[model samples]
Target: MRVGGTGHRLLHAETARMVERALHERLARLPADVLVGVSSLADGADQLFAEAILALGGSLEVVLPASRYREALPAECLGAYDRLLASATVVERLAYEDSTSEAHMEAGRMVVDRSDVLVAVWDGHPARGVGGTGDVVAYARKRGVPVEVVWPRGAAR
Candidate 1:
């Protein structure tokens, strides 16, 4: 799965759980031949997708948005993030700055291009933040990538 957006973390409490649960449910439907490429940032949806992929015995590729994990996210999620990196079959960095940086944005395009499935856990709204979650989704759609948008049902985007 090529994951996009920040709905995994920024949603309201229950909303986060709902989106996570939905992601898990969606992952269960993927075939065994599928390889899940997960970007490692200890936020909400991305981590949940990694866990689900691991549980399903699928191969995981951790694509970090930056060369160094420390520079990308906070100290708290670092432990879980490290565990993810360790378990991944392939670990790569974008050789850029944070996910929102220009360099990373170019890198993100490659990530999405490689994905057979795109799972976007957006908050049902346009991104007003740094990460190009919205941009990633748009790219995936434009490329005719199969996308499953898991957001609150009635929320606006």
Candidate 2:
């Protein structure tokens, strides 16, 4: 799985630190040339992992799952997302026709197919209408990709 959700809804500062530490330890065990693909959504687990990957000299491929930055995220998140995109080696826009449309599901499938590993920042459950991290995990699982899920402490719900 080349792309994964950042698990914004179920994370906090301490969890972010823990996740950063865990990912750093894990990435140290991976081959140095591994290319990590991430979504630039800087809410929860995703942002922390992206930062860790970059710090570890790993290349990042950011897949923005929205047509325009402004459409799906708040203005505050756009700046950081753009910074992540700028730092990434490759950036692919998933480009959706509608915010609530399922068309992006195919795009997700393609990203998953291209990725060798899938990491999700899950909160333990799915969000009702947003098609949250669960959607990405499901796609990766369907492809038999390796998955690493990061959950905040006490986040089981």
Candidate 3:
């Protein structure tokens, strides 16, 4: 099973906990041997989904939006980002040199295109920017990719 993810980069502590648990539960349903998580590994939900997949003994396939993608992440998220990147079973780097919105959306499109299902941690809102969770969800829907939204009750960004 191939699952991709996209969501907010900033999440409240409690909301993150809820989202993480929800991601774990959803991904846990898949057989570990066949499970493969595809992600861009952004700070919040993307990292959460990857972690869940790793915890479940699933393989991770990373798709970096640009060559400078690591520099685009927040300082606090750097450590985990590096760790996850190192752990990826397969890593694909895009041709772009800068981590711009266009690169991000293209990366998200790549994930959707490679996925059997997209596990979105969106809060049922419009995207704040061009490549946000909502935009990814919309693209997934347009591409006819099955999307399982995993916004836990009482969760907020």
Candidate 4:
């Protein structure tokens, strides 16, 4: 199955675990032998979901918004991004040289276009910026993609 997701870049530890558990439960419903996870590998929810996919023996497909994605990520998240990138079965980088909001939106479109289902770890808040989690979820819905929102009760950013 082709699965993609979007969520916050920063998450509380409890929230992170909750998202992971939810991802685990969702992934459990699929056949273990041929699961694929598509994501940007962002610091919080995205990374957690990727890790869970890997843990469940699924293939990871990373979609980078721009060539300078590494530079855009916080220094602390660089290592995690690199690790996940190294393990990805596929890594597609957009043509943009810098990380811009437009680039991010295009990248999100790419993910949504390729996904059969989208898992959003949103908190029901308005999007803070272009290509934010809520915006991507909206995009997915607008495109008629099946979306599974996974914000556990009491989860916070």
Worst 10 residues of 2 by lDDT: 1-10
Candidate 4 collision pairs: none
Candidate 2 vs candidate 3, lDDT winner: 3
* lDDT by residue (tens digit), candidate 2, 1-157: 2444345444555776777787677666666566465554545566667776777777787766566544665565567666777898877766564544363455445556766777676665664444556776776887798777776465443
- Candidate 4 residue-wise lDDT, 1-157, digit = tens: 9899778888888888888899899888887688888998888989988888898988999999999888988898888889999999999999999999989888888888989999888898978999998889999999999998889988987
Q: Local distance difference test, per candidate?
A: 0.63, 0.62, 0.93, 0.88
* Higher-scoring candidate on lDDT, 3 or 4: 3
Candidate 1 Cα errors over 4 Å, as ranges = 1-8, 97-100, 152-157
What TM-score do all the candidates reach, one by one? 0.80, 0.76, 0.98, 0.96
Model 3 residue 130 lDDT? 91
Model 3 lowest lDDT segment of ten: 1-10
- Model 4 ranges with Cα > 4 A deviation: none
Predicted candidate 3 versus true structure: per-residue lDDT over 49-110, tens digit per residue: 99999999999999999999999899999999999999999999999999999999999999
Model 3 clashes, total count: 0
User: On a 0 to 1 TM-score scale, where does candidate 2 land against the true structure?
Assistant: 0.76
lDDT-based ranking:
3, 4, 1, 2
RMSD over all Cα atoms, model 1: 3.1
